[model samples]
Target: MKTKPLYLNDCYIHQFQADITEIGDDFIVLNETYFYSRGGGQPGDTGDIAGIVITDTKRDGDGKILHYFEGDCNLSSGQSVQCHIDWPRRYAHMRIHSASHIVEYFLFRHSDNQKFLSSFISGGKETSTYEVTAAITPEIVEKIQHDANAFIKGNHDILLYPDENNPDYRYCKIGDIVYPCGGTHPKNTSEIGEISIKVKGQAALGKQKIVTTLMP
Candidate 1:
């Protein structure tokens, strides 16, 4: 059975209750889940289900969300489970993911429409990096950072909604700028807090990589 992804509509859901539809050696598939699977540069969510610690969340080839945990699960199919996600880690990712979008906007505007090739948020939760198709200079980086900070301080509200053309696809809109994304993010730009951006070296001869981190 296809599992409903609750987080697609609400990113702030830290805990939820669901029924187990399937069970494996170390993983369980829920009827519905708020846990985010590892994809689009964001790491999978780790949490606990009925006090059993979930170490990772992923989707199988058939599109079933597999919630993996350590140790033997004394649970069985059709059992009701109380799920709690690692809120701190999930929140950190939410902030960083939003920051990357802000930085990308500024970078594109200042750097001749430099395109993002890929992005990754570390499992360690220390930094989020985005690789672009073109080189990023020190001056460009400085300008992007300044513009991003000003944008954040403006306190723009964020909206995530389904694209009119495709309900399966989603858009992340911060103020006037809209980006196609499916990652979790805070409701407002100001919630991201202060961020620090730095160049993280090149991924290839022509690609530039930059890292963004949240400031304490």
Candidate 2:
């Protein structure tokens, strides 16, 4: 069965109950799950299920959310399990994901309509990256950082909801800017705190990789 993704609707849900539908050698597919499967530049979630350590969560080619766990697996299908996601880690991703959007918003305002090519959230809260189609000189990166921080400091409310026309799709709106996004995010910009940004490197022949991190 395709796992019902609970995280899409509520980013703050750290714990949930799910029924195991399928069990693999090291992974289990749930009838529903709160785990955010790895995709769209965000890393997979890791936590625990019935005292078992879930090493990672990912979607299979068949569209099942596979909860991969460490050590032995004695669980059976149709078994109900209590699950708990590592809140700090998931919250960190939310902050970084939201901060990345803020950075992209300002980057667009300064980069002369440069395209946001791609992005990635590392496993840790320390860093995330955005790939753009422009050279993105140091001056522009600095300007974007300043503006992004200003926007974060404004503590603007962020809303994530399904598209009016397509419930399967999602959008993230902060202030007056709206972005097409499906990743998790904090409820307010203030939760992201301050962020530091810099040019990481070239991701492709013509794409520049910019890195952003939550500031101390």
Candidate 3:
């Protein structure tokens, strides 16, 4: 059975109702899910499914997605379940995801440089880190932080087009500035609030590591 990925279409969906299709030794498969399976640098979503603490989620080959519970719960195949997500954590990820794109856009625009890659959400709790491929000099970090804030302050539009051929495609703009993306983002830059960046120095000879965050 195909697992419906609800979060992909709506990041704000914190709860959903689904039916259990199969149960495995290590995980449970759902007919549909709001829980994000670990992938795309972003971590999998966590929450509760029918009073069961969903500790982690992952996808396997053959297109089957699994939801791993922290402890055993009385769940049976064909049974109905209500899945709820940890919104605070998911929201943080949403912001970081958007902020990462903003950083990438600015880095490309200002540096007039391309080919630099690598981006993901790292670190954890009270201090999540958004890492991107770019040297994190103090000056550059400051500039990126400033630019990201400015963009947020401008309250630019964040539009999501589900039928744009590429389901992951996203567009953001401030006046005339526009760019394409394929990850979850806030409805507007203002939703991002405050942002900061720290360069982890050059990863290799020329590769760099940049860590970003939303100020708490």
Candidate 4:
């Protein structure tokens, strides 16, 4: 199995020493990695692995994570290599991801008659969009956005716990609010900064497609 360092700590950006476990025609599998593979709606990390620009990262069906390089490298299996992540990009993702959770949390709380089924982050140049499952109106979207920012301004703490029994575990709590999540998030809500949401067309007859964006 491929070692996933990001799961242990989302903030980890540098791994000076890692062993190359396998290499393929277009990718290399590391014995350990800090790169966050594409999952949970969050984008995979972009950075350098053994001085080669890592263009993409993904996990295979067998759970083996692969790092694809932009250029050729003299790396080999069992060879020690250094890994470095683009901290600013990853941090931005963390902030936006946390904001998304807050938005979902309040949307559910405010719309007690409704429930949130899913959410995903769509990356862009200067901003990331979060598509959430909810039947929200424009006014309700605005209220939820405002309330989420209010919670962010309050600087509520965010925590992550890895359960061996339930490896895919996610739970967020803000005061009396509590919800389940499996994605990475910021340490505190304040780190999320300003955010906005645009209510898109309906996903179905009753479901709304809301796109939440982090303001620049």
> What's each prediction's TM-score?
0.92, 0.91, 0.82, 0.82
Output the TM-score of candidate 3: 0.82
Worst 10 residues of 4 by lDDT: 124-133
lDDT (10s digit) by residue, model 1, range 1-216:
888888878999999999999999999899999999888888889999998899999988887899999888888899998999999999998888888888888877887634556788973233434445666878888898889989999999999999888987999999998999888889999998887788767646555677887888
> What's model 1's overall lDDT?
0.84
Global lDDT of each model?
0.84, 0.83, 0.70, 0.70
> What value of lDDT does candidate 2 attain over all alpha carbons?
0.83
Please give the range of 10 consecutive residues that has the lowest summed lDDT in model 3. Answer: 123-132
What TM-score does structure 4 among the candidates reach? 0.82
* Tens digit per residue, CA lDDT, model 3, 1-216: 878767667768888899999987758899988787876567787888888887788888866789887556689999998889888887887777777777766766665433645456753212223334444467766887788788878877666555468664555443355655444556777887788777664534555566777887
**Which residue runs of candidate 4 sit more than 4 Å off their true CA positions?**
112-118, 124-135, 168-177, 203-207
Q: Clashing pairs in model 3? A: 136-199
On lDDT, the candidate that comes out on top is 1
Q: Which candidate has the highest TM-score of all?
A: 1
lDDT of 4 by residue, 73-169 (tens): 7878889888887777777777777777667677666665444445566552122223334456778888988888887888788877656588657
In model 4, the number of clashes is 1
What's the lDDT for candidate 4? Answer: 0.70
What's each prediction's clash count?
Answer: 0, 0, 1, 1
Instruction: State the displacement of the C-alpha of residue 210, model 3, in Å, after optimal TM-score superposition.
Output: 0.6
